[model samples]
Target: MEPAADASAQSTAERGRLLFHAGLCAGCHTAEDGAPLAGGRPIESPYGTFYASNITPDPEHGIGGWSDEDFVRALSEGVSPDGEHYYPAFPYTAFTKLTREDMLAIKAYIDDVEPVAQPNREHDLVWYADWRWPLGLWKALFFEPGTFQPVPERGDAWNRGAYLSEAAAHCAECHSPRNLFGAIIDDVRYAGADAGVEGGSTPNITPSKDQGIGSWTQDMLAFYLEIGMDPDGDFAGGAMAHVIDVGTGKLSAEDRDAIAEYILSLPPIER
Candidate 1:
C-alpha cells in the first residue's frame, strides 16, 4: 500500500508536469529553459513593457511558500501571494475560470519542480502605467473573477470545450479584442483583430458567413489547433504557431473536439 501511494504521488507529479507544458506557463513566465516558474521573460506590449513574474516554489521569490488557498487566490482572484493585484499581462483574467482543482494541479507541479532564486523583473511602464494601485478599479471595470458558467443545454463534451476555451486555454486572451485598458471587449467576442506575435490580428472565429471562420469545418479547426496546418496547407506562424506548438498540441482529441464544437456554436458575424 505504501508503494502504491508513492507511485500514485509520482503519477500526480507527472500530470502536473504535463499540465505546465500544456498551459504554456513556461513560455511567458520563464526565460528559455530557465527555472520552471521563476519568471524572467519580457513581454513587449504597445501599452508598455511587461515582465513575467516568478511563479516557482521558492518561498520568498517564487510561489514555493504559497498555500493552496494562496494559489487559488492568484489564479481565481488575480491576487498575488501578498494580496497584490496582478496586471492583466499575467492573463489571470482568463485564468480566473480555471477550477480550483486545476489551479492546485498547476501549483503542485510547480512545487515539485526546482525553485529558481532569481528576482522578478520590474515593469518599465510610463508613470501613468506605473500606477499599479489602480488595478482594483481596473478589475472593477474590466475584470470579473468567476468560475466558468456551464451550459446546461450542452453535453459534457461541449461543457469540457467551454472549460478549455474559457479557462485553461484562454483562447480569447489573444483572439479577442481589448479596450484601451487591455480589457477584453466581450461584446465583439471572437471578432478579428491584430493580436498574434508581431501584433498580427487573429482571424475571426465566429461562424460568420463571410468575415469569420464559418468556412472551417470542425475537423479543420481541430487539425489547425493540433498541428497548425489547415486544409489549404497554410501553416500558422508567430504566436499562433507557438500556441499550437506548446499549448493546443498537448490537448487530447476529445478536448480539441470540444473546443471546435464550442467555437462553431458561436454566432457568425461579418466583421
Candidate 2:
C-alpha cells in the first residue's frame, strides 16, 4: 500500500513534468540565464512588449500564496489573484481549455519546485493598451473558457493530439495571424503569421503544398519537431529553437507523432 502511494505520487510528478513541457511553460517563463520559471523574459508584439511573469513558488514574487481557485481563475478566466486582467499575451486563451486535473497537476509541480524571489516586470504596452477594463469587453467578444471535449468520431490518439495541439502546445497562438483587435483570425489559422511572439515569423503547418507543410510526411514532421531541423536541412532559430528545446523536444515520441498526425490532418489553406 505504501509503495502504491509512492508510485502514485511519482506518476503525478512525472505527468506534471511532461505537461509543463507540453504546455511550453518554460519557453515564456524562463529567461536566459535566469532562474527556472523566474520569468523576466520579454515577448515582443505589435501592441507592446509583454514581460513574462514569475510562476515560481516564491510567496512574495510568485504564485506561492495563491489559492487553487485563484490559479484556476487566472488561467481559465484571465483574471489575477487581485482581480486584475491579464493581457492576451499570456496565452490563457489556450490554457482555458485545460482540464482542472491537468491545471492542478501543473500547480503541484510548480509548488514543489525551487522558489525564486523574482518580481514580475510590468508590460510595456502602447498608451491605449494599458487599460484593463476594456479586456472585459474583449473577453465577451472572443473568450470561451471550456475544457477540451473528445470527438467521438476520432480515435483516442487523434483526440489526444487535438487536446495537445489546441490546449497544450497552442500551436495556433503563434502560427495563426491576428486581427488588429488582437484576436486570432480563424479564417487563416495555421496559415503562417508575419509577426508572432517576439515579433518573429511563424511558418504554416497546414497541409498546403505551396504555403504550408503540405509536402512533408508525418515522419518528416515528427523528426523535425524532435530535432528542430526542417526538410530543407535548415535548423530552426530564435524562439522556435527555444520552443523545440524546452517544449516539443522534451515530449515523448508518441506525443510528437500525435502532433504530426494532427498537423497533417489540417485542411491546407494557401495564403
Candidate 3:
C-alpha cells in the first residue's frame, strides 16, 4: 500500500510539474542566480518595479502551509491567505481561467521544491499602490474570474491549444496592448503592444499579414516555439527568449502544435 501510494503521489506531482512549466511559474518566481521559486525577481511596470514573491515550500516565507482553498483563491481571484487582494501584476487575470485540477497540479509541483527561508521583496510602486483593498474594484470592472471553456465546434487539438494559450501560457497578457487603466483593449486583442514589458514591443500574433504572423506557417510557429528561431532566420530575444527557455520550449510537441493552432485562429488584427 505504501509503495502504491508513493507511485500515485509521484504521478500527480509529475502532472503538476508539467502544469508549472506551461504556466511559466519558474520564469517569474526564480530570479537571476537565485534559488528556484525562492522569488526576488523584479518586474518593471509603468507604475514601478514589482518583485515576485517566494513560492518555495518554506513554512515561514513560502506557501508551504497554504491549504487547497488558499492556493485556489490566490490564483483564481488574486486574493491572499489573509484575505487581501493582490496586485494584478501577478497575472492572476490570466490564471483565473485555469481549472481547479490544473491549479492543484501546479501546487503539487511547487510542493516538491526544497523549502527556502528567503523573504519576499516589496513592490516599488506609486505611493498609493500599497492600498490593495481597491484592487477589488479593479477586479469588478476588468477582471472576470472563470475557468477555460472550450468552444463547442472546435476540434480537440484546437480546444487543447486554447486551454494552453489562454489558461496556461497566458499569451494575451503580453501580446495584447493594455489601456491606461491596465485592462487589455478588446478591439486590439493580440494586436501587439507598442511598449510592453521592459519597454520593448511585443509582436502582433493575430495572423495579420501586414503586422502579425500571417505569413508564417503553423509548422514554422511551432518550430519557433521549440527553438526560438523564426522562419525569417531571426531569433527571438529579450523576455520572449526567457519564456521559450523555461516555458514553451519545454512543452510537448503536441502542446506546441496546439498553441500554434489556437493562435492562428485568432482574429487578424493589424496593429
Backbone clashes, each candidate: 7, 0, 0
- Candidate 1 residue-wise lDDT at 87: 82
TM-score of model 1 relative to the true fold?
0.90
Lowest summed lDDT window (length 10), candidate 2: 154-163
On TM-score, the stronger of 1 and 3 is: 3
Deviating ranges (above 4 Å) for candidate 1: 1-19, 33-35, 195-198
Q: If scored against the real structure, what TM-score would every candidate get?
A: 0.90, 0.97, 0.96
Point out where model 3 deviates above 4 Å. 2-8
Candidate 2 lDDT tens digits, 130-202: 9999998999998889998988998877888888899989999999999888989999998988988798889
Question: What lDDT tens digits, residue by residue, belong to model 1 across residues 135-219?
Answer: 9999998888898889898899889888888787777777777778777788887876665433567778888867888889998
Between prediction 1 and prediction 3, the one with superior lDDT is 3
Q: Model 2 segments beyond 4 Å from truth?
A: none
RMSD to the native, candidate 2?
1.1
Model 2: residue 131 alpha-carbon error in angstroms:
0.6
Give RMSD to native, each candidate.
2.2, 1.1, 1.4
Deviation from native of the Cα of residue 118 in model 2, angstroms:
1.3
- Please estimate how well model 2 matches the true structure, expressed as its whole-model Cα lDDT: 0.90
